[model samples]
Target: MLVTGGTGGLGGAVTAAFIEAGWRTVVPVRKKTSAESRSGAVGRGPGSNRDPKATPAEGDAVYVSADLTDPASVDAAVAVAAGEPAAPLRAVVNLVGGYAASGLVHETPIEDFERMLSLNLRPTYLVTHAALPHLLAAGGAVVCVSSRAAVAPFAGAAGYVTAKAAVVAFANAVAVEYRQRGVRCNTVLPSVIDTPANREAQPDADHSRWVAPADIAKVIHFLCGDESAPTTGATIPVYGRA
Candidate 1:
């Protein structure tokens, strides 16, 4: 299994879940130091104070340095993950995306709109495009993260809304094109994930209603398991009462 954005809060949870489930998890980080730190600290909370150099538990995780937005970098990451003789690549979880709140559609610049698309969709497309052949060879599964804003849009984030919606569409397209080939693709929509970053961003908002990273990670892990083999092109909502 390969997880992009695995150094992040949610991604850390997902990577740990897969590793716990006995999958040889490979996480791609942008910097070597980031990868090194993450390899030793999978699933640690944002507030963790553990020594960064401490050795991780056996079979904790493997980290590779790659930029998802770069095609060559993505390919290199995939190659490293797939090269594992005992556990060839069988799953890809795309958590590499960003959120940007802009003015209303009329006030938003074209560049901002394009930037949103590039930020959210380009890495997804590039990584998936490069991994398709490996996934096809192994009959694998894919899980992508899309925002609730894609379907339940609010004001002042036209670019973000549009780009996230496009992500769902792209996942559906992949599902349709690869279903017969034993490859499944699905998207999970989350709303206000309860991460430290989010709490810092919305200090006054009620955190009780926000979804937890562990909760979403479990859902994603299930999607990649055999029980969900019958599921594909599904847009499952992971919103937590908000």
Candidate 2:
């Protein structure tokens, strides 16, 4: 399994669940995005990216350091995931995402707009392209992490809504292109995931109403597993009331 942004709350739960299920996992991360890494919120080292912290105590796990926005780093991470001597990557879950520039498009800087696109969209494009050869070899699955924001705009995040909207459509496009080849593609659209960013971004909101990482991870595990074989080109929303 290959999970991008795999050290954060949702990513960590997905990684842990897959490990429990006996699937070796490779998590890619970009540690330098900020001083307080999202991975730290889940009790993992930052800047180590996906360096395989201290060797997994149980099922296999490795960290591949890569900045998805950089084509070279993205390619390197892809190489690391597929080059594994094991059965090769059977699934890829893109969990890398961010919300930037909470303003009208005209007010947001062009750079912030591009950054959001890189964070939410480009990783899906680059990593999926990189992993295709191996996933095709394994005849496996491709899953993109999207948001309910794609369908309904939040009060102040026009950029986030736009980026996720693209992801929703892009995942479907990928599914359409690959479904005939025995490969499956899908998107997990969660609403108000209880992450540090969401908490900070909406301080006054009732966080208890949001979906938890474990809850979303369960859906991801199901999508990657065999039972979801008949599924493709679908967006499964796992949003809580928020």
Candidate 3:
């Protein structure tokens, strides 16, 4: 399993869930230092040590340095993840995305709109494009993350809403293109994920209704597993209580 953004709050939970389920997880990080630091974050559960230089001597999870937005870098990262012939790459969870709240369409800068698209969509397209051949050969699964705002939009975040909606559309396209080849693609839409960063961002919000990272991770893991073999092009909403 190759989990992009596996070092982040939600991605870390996803990586840890896969590892706990006995999958050899490979995470792509942009920097060697970030990879080294994330080694401890994803290998274990949330709130684990985050030492900038801590390196696990041996573990089921390994981090490879690669810029996900670049095709060459994504290809190299995929090669490293699919290194062993015995254990080919079987799953790709694209969690390499971001959220930005900007003004209305007229008030937002063109650069901000482009950045939103680049940040939320480019890495997913690049990584999935580069990994399709291997996934086709292995009959694997592809999972992407989209936001609830995509379907149920609010004011003042036009760029984020549009970008997230594009993600879902891209995943649906992949599902249609590869369903016969045994490559399943699906998107998960989350609503206000309950992470430390989010809590800090919205200090007074009712976090009890927010979804947990671990919960979403479990959903992603299920989508990648054999139980969901018949499920493809499904946009599953993982809004916990919210």
Candidate 4:
């Protein structure tokens, strides 16, 4: 498995969930870290934001260093996951995106607009492209983290919304094109996934009602597993108190 953006809040939770579920996850991280042992430190770091109202998974997790945006880094990681022919990659979960500028198109500079698209959209396409051969061979799955902002209009975030919308649409189209090859694809449109970034942005909001990363991880794991074989080209909404 190839998990992009494994250093973040949701990515860590997703890693834990997959490990607990016995799915050997290969997180393509960017930077190096000293905190390596998740089997012992499991649920220690960011589980502080766990959902009080939701059930959580249990298990250990592993990590690998790889950058998503850089093509060489992407290629190197994907090669290890799928091209190796040793540890075949049966799934790819794209969690590489983040919120962009929250301003009107005119107010948001071209650099910011392009940066948002670069940050949110390109990683998915590049990683997906690199992993296509392995996906085709293993009949793997791809789960993209889109947002409600992609479909439902949000104020002062035209660039962000448009980029996310493209991601959702891309997943659907990829799902259709690759379905015949036994590969599945789906998009998760999360309303407010509880993460450090979100908490920092909306400090006063009732985070108790916010959706946990593990919750999204469970949904993503399902989408990548055997149960969702017939669930390709679909968009799942994961709204919390919205």
In Å, residue 32's CA in model 1 sits off its true spot by 2.3
What C-alpha lDDT values do all the predictions have? 0.86, 0.79, 0.86, 0.78
Model 3's alpha-carbon lDDT is: 0.86
Misplaced by over 4 Å in model 1 are: 34-59
Arrange candidates, best lDDT first: 3, 1, 2, 4
Give the distance in Å from residue 8's predicted Cα in candidate 2 to where it truly belongs. 1.1
lDDT of 1 by residue, 26-113 (tens): 8888766444555455432222243333433533567777888889999998898788676778899999989887798999999999
TM-scores of all candidate predictions against the true structure: 0.90, 0.85, 0.90, 0.86
lDDT: worst 10-residue window of model 2? 41-50
Clashing residue pairs, candidate 2?
Answer: 50-63
Looking at candidate 4, the ten consecutive residues that score lowest on lDDT are 39-48
Flag clash pairs in model 1: none
Taking the tens digit of each residue's C-alpha lDDT, what string does model 4 give over 29-52? Answer: 554444444333422222323442
**Evaluation by TM-score, superior candidate among 1 and 4:** 1
Cα lDDT for residue 204, model 4? 96
